[model samples]
Target chain A: MYEERHHSEILEDVLQFIYPLIILFGLYIILTGISQPGGGFQGGAVLVAIFMCRYLVSPREMGRLDLIQKIDKLILVFILALASMLILLGFREVIPYFNGIYNMLIGILIGIKVASGLTVIFYTFAFIEGGKED
Target chain B: MMPVVEKIMYIALIIFAFMSVQTPKLRRAVVYLAVFSAGSAFVYVLLGAPDAALAEAVIGSTIATIIFLSALQKYKAFTVYYTNEMRHEYRQSNLFRRRNAVLERIENFCSGKDLEAHIMYTTESLQEVMKNHGWDIIVRRKNNKFSIYGMEQNYHIEEMKKYIDENFNDLRKLGYEIELHIGWSENE
Candidate 1:
């Protein structure tokens, strides 16, 4: 069991400024992932770090994250279905932009999936260790 | 230019790896390992493997660190020191059999809450334990009566108190009373 530590007001104030920027940066990474060096996984990890930082600031108010877990699992199923459809269709040079659109959609889905999955994990640990009921 | 940067990255990787292993706290170690992963990802980039580098930077540095830190939390054991009024002989076999209903209830509560319960049947008094070693909960028994001492901020203990009061209401006929005392605990 871990005790909930009270952080200084300055720390919370600084986080207020920095937290939104971190989230914005994570979104930037996710949106530009297809063309840039970073992809869905890297951007998703950044998003997870944003959630983790909030917990670091205030362990008491983790809020409900069960929705995120449900969405994460739902996205996983969607990804599997999409992958199977792609294999079955066999888009062999028929449409040029179809491949690009497919990749972009898949990348977006993966990014959201990873972000929600990691956030749920963070909340789960925070629930047990920080001792917040939900 | 690339070779020089690659050489520096390799040296940094080695240092981070060494520091991670040698760090006293697991949290610090996780940070160092993340740095090590970042350095390795840079090295991969220099070697013209961007795909591998991206995977390394994300999975190895961020996701893996979070997972390791979460797993490390399980190491903090939830200790319960139970001291009976009459000191029984320290028999390894009978210790399990000698467990009272209250202790059994505590074990059940701890298990249901996912806390690793480390219950120790001690011969020492509560004052000695409070003044000496660190502990989460203390259960003392005196003449078929039980008093459970827990930290005031401990929600789990509060839940346990409610559980006992609700479940063991029938035990009043057996001349047994379970009392819960919540107060400030050391190391809070």
Candidate 2:
């Protein structure tokens, strides 16, 4: 499978060039989500392309999934905590410019959560489960 | 009118949805699903829901497609390597023609079992192929004898053994010794 992945040199070269651009685009979608059509979910899904592209470039190398999984769970906890603080505890009353800051913070957190969560899911399906057959 | 474009998108969405479900090959189905997702995203945009469109486009077309493809890589694909030892070039050999007839039967059996038959013709010696390649079955032809090497744990090979026994009884009567070599062990 690794040998088969190296069949196209052009794909590897082009992916190297396009990878950073994909990250930039995903980040753009995530950050500008407050005033734009795209939000955390869309940006996170776009970010998944980065890992997919990496797999395309080198099928043998399994990414740091444990770290991503950790990030996923940790971000989920943070989102819940932040949401509880804003809504249940009424922290919005305590802070100035709370709405914009809360929205931005939540969007960023959700973006990271979605990105890491999807990355973990992708790796699990692509590598972990597939590896069991071999 | 805008309604015409919306109708076209709806029709495309329905067509792609049906194609994704109806396709025999899993990879093609993933592609169809991606197209369906993209079409639905367009429809969402037309319905003045750009937010839903963005989400749909990214999740359906990008993430889901990758996940489906990854899952499919481990799907049932039966790999068979065919090597002719008596002749270095297989195309001109009489055994090659004979092997093709048997191969067609194996392919039919594979399809019946919902397995994609991935057959490769190699020039390597049996020992070299056995030592190097990852294969489900290796069909080797040496003169009139045919040796099929498979793992003991492979249930598909067991079914194939039965299939060959039932179908190729005529070939055995013609002095063609079809030997099924199992118990190769998992550790090479």
lDDT of each: 0.78, 0.84
Q: Summarize candidate 1's per-residue lDDT along B1-188 as a digit string, tens digits.
A: 98999898888889999999997556678999999998998899999988678778877987788777657554556779888758854678787677677777777777677676778888887788767766788989888888888887666777877887887776666889888888855553
Candidate 1 Cα misplacement greater than 4 A, ranges: A1-4, A88-96, A129-134, B23-27, B66-188
Q: Place model 1 in a CAPRI quality band.
A: incorrect
Task: Please write out the lDDT profile of model 1 over residues A22-130, one tens digit for every residue.
Answer: 7787777767777777777777777787777777677667676877878999999999998998889777457778877887778878888988987887787766555
Tens-digit per-residue lDDT, B1-188, candidate 2? 99999999999889999998998766888999999999999999999999999999888887788777767766778989888876666565764556576577777888789887888888898888888988889998888888889888787888888988898888889888887888666454
List DockQ, one per candidate, in order.
Answer: 0.18, 0.61
How well docked is model 1, in DockQ terms?
Answer: 0.18
- Cα error, residue A81 of model 1, in Å, equals 2.9
Worst 10 residues of 2 chain A by lDDT: A125-134
lDDT of 2 at B26: 68
Candidate 2: chain B TM-score equals 0.68
Q: Which stretches of candidate 2 lie over 4 Å from their true place?
A: A1-9, A87-97, B82-104, B121-134, B138-155, B165-188
Docking model 2 quality class:
medium
